[model samples]
Target: MTTVAFVLAGIAALIHVYIFRLESLAWTDPKTRAVFGTTAETAEVTKPLAYNQGFYNLFLAIIAVIGIAVGAFGSASSDDVSTALIHAACGSMVAAALVLATSDSSKLRGAVIQGVAPALAILALLLS
Candidate 1:
């Protein structure tokens, strides 16, 4: 049970890191910018929003990574704290998925698949 939990949470954290990398690193490149469906003008226009959102995601991912590490490796005394932090991360992920879905329905399919998967993951952890 413990190993399963750690593996799942660690994968989630790593995925978050990958997402942050996509948002922060990839979008900066002119070539990758096109993949984001942004023209040069639009990219410049939404630069601040993109930058802020990327930063927020980076911090969120870092928190999630810490939570996973703590949950897996921290002492028994810190279990509750680690769980609480991961729960917070889960909540944030759900929120972010919703926001993405609503704003970019094409990218994430607003609350359908995107929201469902993470919600299920969080539920699994909670109910386990």
Candidate 2:
């Protein structure tokens, strides 16, 4: 269960890192615009906001990755801290997805994409 949790969290972290790239590095790119369903003008106008939001995603992913690493390789004394980090990071991801899904019905698919792996990781961690 612990391994499963770490693997799922790793996947969620990777997904967020990809999201960060799309949002921060390529927000105005045609492909990214298409993925986000945004017009060029809107993308341009929202670029700053997206850039900042992308960092938030990146930070969450970092926290999860760090937690996975600590849990896997850190000293026994650090186990509780690693667990807390994982829960905090993945919980934030799930909460953000829930907010997005509730705020806009059309974004449900995106919400699921954003949330599922982290949610599963949390569940597996609990079972572990």
Candidate 3:
């Protein structure tokens, strides 16, 4: 169960990292704009906002990665710290997704994309 939890958390972290890259580094790129359903002008205008939001995602991913590393490789004494980190990171990810979903119905897909893995990871951890 621990392994399953960590793996799912890792997957969620990777997704967030990709999101960070898209929003922070490629928000105005044609492909990124297409994926986000934004016009080039809109993407350009919103680039600063996206960059800031991207860092938020990056930070969450980093937290989750830290949890995974501590849980998998750190001494047994650190288990509580590892669990706390994972719970906090995954919980925040879930909350952000819920906010996105509630803020706009059209963003449902994006919310699901952002939340599912973290939700699963949380479930796995709880069950474990």
Candidate 4:
């Protein structure tokens, strides 16, 4: 369970960073723009949804770091580490997903990643 959490959290961090890049000037850089299908025009007018995504991602990265740090510090109990981190991560995901779902309704993957994965992860942890 810990391994699964770590891997997913790490991947989520990486992906969120990428999303941030796309929202920031990374979309302006030709080299960076190629990967995300963005253009300079977008750099001038960032979408609200994208900004929200970026903001959530920033929080996600911080939460992921906290999760790993707590694990390393030997505080994986319910009241201390595991419960707090998992609950936070799941909550972040749910909020992001809801924002995307209600705001845009186009970024299905964003909705799923942010909305669905966290709840499912929590359920899995409970079952285990």
Best by lDDT: 2
lDDT of 1 by residue, 17-113 (tens): 6555656666656875765667777777777777666677667657766777787788998878777776777678778788877787676743443
Model 2: residues with Cα > 4 Å off, grouped in runs: none
TM-score of candidate 2 on Cα atoms, chains taken together: 0.98
Best by TM-score: 2
| Candidate 4 CA-lDDT value | 0.62
Backbone clashes counted, model 3: 0
TM-score of 4: 0.66
Candidate 3 per-residue lDDT, tens place, 48-80, comes to 999999999999999999999999989999988
lDDT of 1 at 93: 73
Instruction: Name the candidate, 2 or 3, with the larger TM-score value.
Output: 2
The TM-score ranking, best first, is 2, 3, 1, 4
How would you encode candidate 4's per-residue C-alpha lDDT over 60-122 as one tens digit per residue? 767766775666566436335755786687667667778778887566666776555565555
- The true-versus-predicted C-alpha distance at residue 46 of model 3, in Å, is 0.7
lDDT of the candidates, in the order given: 0.65, 0.96, 0.94, 0.62
1-128 per-residue lDDT for model 2 (tens digits): 99999999999999999999999999999999998889999999999999999999999999999999999999989889889999999999999999999999988999999999999999999999
- Pairs of colliding residues, candidate 4: none
Candidate ordering by lDDT (highest first):
2, 3, 1, 4
